[model samples]
Target: MLRSVPSKSQILRYVKGLLITWKLRWRGVDCEGRVVVAGPAPRIWSKGSVKIGNRVLFRTTSRRTSIAVRGDARFEIGEKCFINDGVEIDVWKSVEIGPYCFIGNNTRIADTNYHEIDQGAGPRVDSISIGRNVWLASNVTVLPGVSIGDHSVVAACSVVTKSFPDRSLIAGIPARKIRDIEAADDYIRPG
Candidate 1:
């Protein structure tokens, strides 16, 4: 049997993957296991803490994914999650993304308003909790204090401003539950 040879692009990608892995480690990210970075490298700036679980894939393009954690905030992404290109996560408090979730391209998840409403008032900040098997469609904006429940799907270009229950089909500007979907047993992670 003849052995197959790796293409130039394949070899380049392999080298890039190794560089990215080393860069992440140098940046002090808490990676439990392997985290794959496709296309361009991601821009990660953490003044607090950043934790990534095993098998997390970041599919970046020219627009590169960005993650920023300010102050003593925490940012955590669970295992087997896919974060698409141009996704920006800015955490001023905490942002927790569960396992098996899909974050579509150009999606924005922020836990702070970034500016105060009043002169002496502080900016609004709170934690964002995304449950397991959740799918956030492209161009979605998940604002502060929003919790997306398990197995939920947020429609494209939707703005999530409130908490949603499990198995919700959420949509609209300030996202509301279009309907409740039947929970799929297959999505449950095995022990």
Candidate 2:
């Protein structure tokens, strides 16, 4: 059997991953175990805290992933989670991402409005909690004060402005539950 040679892009990605790994370690990120960073390096600006669990994968080939934690906020990415390219996470209060979750490309998760709407009003700040095994499709935007329950799936381009229960199939702008995942006839529960 003949062995295949690695392509130029593959080699470049490998090198980039190694460099990103070192960069993350140098930046004092709390990485519990091995973390894989593919493609370009992520832009992480933290003044508070960032915790990344074991075996987390960050795919940043198409675009870079940016994470910002301001003030005394906390940001966490649980074990076995897959974060696709172009994902942006802004935490002014707190953002907790549970294990086995899938964040599709270009998804944005923010816990702050970033700016005040009224002249004297302060920016809205809140916490975001994403439960285990949740899947947020590409272009999904999760606004402030939203909690997504375990095993829930939010469709692409959804704008989530509220909380969703476990096993829900959420979609549309200002996301509403399309149906219960387990209740669907074609739904197959993972063993």
- Which structure among the candidates has the greatest TM-score? 1
Query: Which segments of model 1 are wrong by more than 4 Å?
Result: 1-15, 118-120, 185-191
RMSD of 1: 3.2
lDDT of 1 by residue, 1-191 (tens): 99899999878877776677778878998888777888778899999899998878899965799999988999999998999999999999999999999999999999998899999898899899999989999999999999999999999999999999999999999899999988775675322
Model 2 scores a C-alpha lDDT of 0.88
* lDDT (C-alpha) at residue 113 in model 1: 89
Tens digit of lDDT per residue, candidate 2, span 32-126? 77677876667899988999888788888889999999888999999889999999999999999998889999999999888999998989899
Q: Name the lDDT value of residue 109 in candidate 2.
A: 97
Error of 1 at 77 (Å): 0.2
Instruction: Give Cα-based local distance difference scores for all models.
Output: 0.90, 0.88
Weakest 10 consecutive residues of candidate 1 by summed lDDT: 182-191
| Clash list (residue pairs), candidate 2 | none
Candidate 2 local lDDT, residue 44: 94
